[model samples]
Target: MNTKLIAALSVLLVAPAMSATSLDLGYKAYTSDTRDDNAGAYNQPFLKLSHFNKADWGTLFAYVKLENPGEVKDAQHGADGKLTVKSLAIVDKQIGSSNHNLWMQNFLVSNRTVMEDNLYLGLTTNQKFGDLFINAGAGINYSAASFSPTNASFDGLSGAAAVINARYPFALAGLKHSLTVNYEGQFGRDGEHKQTLGYDSYGHQLITTLKTNLTKSVYTKLHLTQFDSWGATPNDGIEYGIAIGMSF
Candidate 1:
């Protein structure tokens, strides 16, 4: 981990009372069927920390994710733990015209080689028509060799992806509840390499989420993720988990 970088971000997050900020800490446990060639499964437990800071340009989000994956056959064989950091910046809501909703920049780094490090810049927009909210975006990705997935085939592979998300919020028990659906598709050479690995050469994921407010400032969320692999990756599977957090 880069202690210096973390320290810098920590300082930015706590700058002053006027800089609206929030932090979330949570845990998730998931099972993957792709492990052991479907002979058994891979289990993972993860710790997640996420922080957000409102800025004049936009909103900044920093996240730390830690997980250990173990297979049923030989838990020790894949016992290595992985730690990752991801940061994202969204354009200020006040900056855009009625024609656009958001713009974003993102970067990710991980301690493990398989996880890779990458940078992305993108444009995203959200809209509401009645009770349904919709979002869409596209981005470019530059994968650094130190963090590129093993199948990337070359150093600094570049890629692109498109995303779509939708949500519906309702009232329940005098509180707010919501259901969200999300989809992301990856395209380009890196995606081709992914396909060669039994994954979708142009990879994609479909995710659904259910969120409910437990209190004025506390919430619980559940997720179900489905993956599509066109015979490219070794571990294409399903994942589900629950998380609880608070907003300040």
Candidate 2:
């Protein structure tokens, strides 16, 4: 009775009889603006789930976050609210077909740990050319300086970031509508060659996004962000969000 345990019990009895399924749970919302005078208005809501593995290496994403009408230009304003948890590994073949991909995370759980960075690399993707999904990766960032509370144990963050993405879809028989876009940039070696903690603190960031996926589990999104720093100054931000999430 041991032909490799009867072929591992007939591959777990035909592997759930041909398994592949989606939709575990989701709800998302977003709002943002740091146009200065009014000084950063924000609303962020998130929930996500993913579990569907079919010889498909890995996939397990979990999330919960909330930030609304929150503001603090000079700094500190009660408990504004933002919670998070994440996990992901979705690589579906291609040193041969070029569906290129990679995502690995250690600690990206944040609220503020001086500025947040306990060791990182929480966002990563790679794929160039159309099945219509491009990719890039980056991480390791932590900062402090909102109005000088003397919290400069400085190692201030971000020395890497790159992004470019696109996604497209239209379906009928099973129902589907998916469209997405992206652009991102960042690099640095923060904190004064001396010691003048103003706030460019040290930076460069540009982000744009859009997303929709009705069936295959459901989705929704919108985002925009821009920031150029080094005290040279230019801080522009905008974000509007929606998410009806689920995927497996």
Would you list the clashing residue pairs of candidate 2? none
- On the 0 to 100 scale, the lDDT of residue 184 in model 2 is 43
Displacement of residue 159 (Cα, Å) in model 1 is 3.3
Residue-level lDDT of model 1, residues 56-159, one tens digit each, is: 43445555555442311223355544443444433323244453444444444344343334444577776899999887778776554331444443335557
TM-score, per-candidate, Cα-based: 0.68, 0.27
lDDT of predicted model 1? 0.55
Question: How large an RMSD does model 1 have?
Answer: 5.5
* Candidate 2: stretches off by over 4 Å: 1-66, 70-148, 151-161, 170-174, 179-185, 192-248
Clash count list over all predictions: 10, 0
Worst 10 residues of 1 by lDDT: 67-76
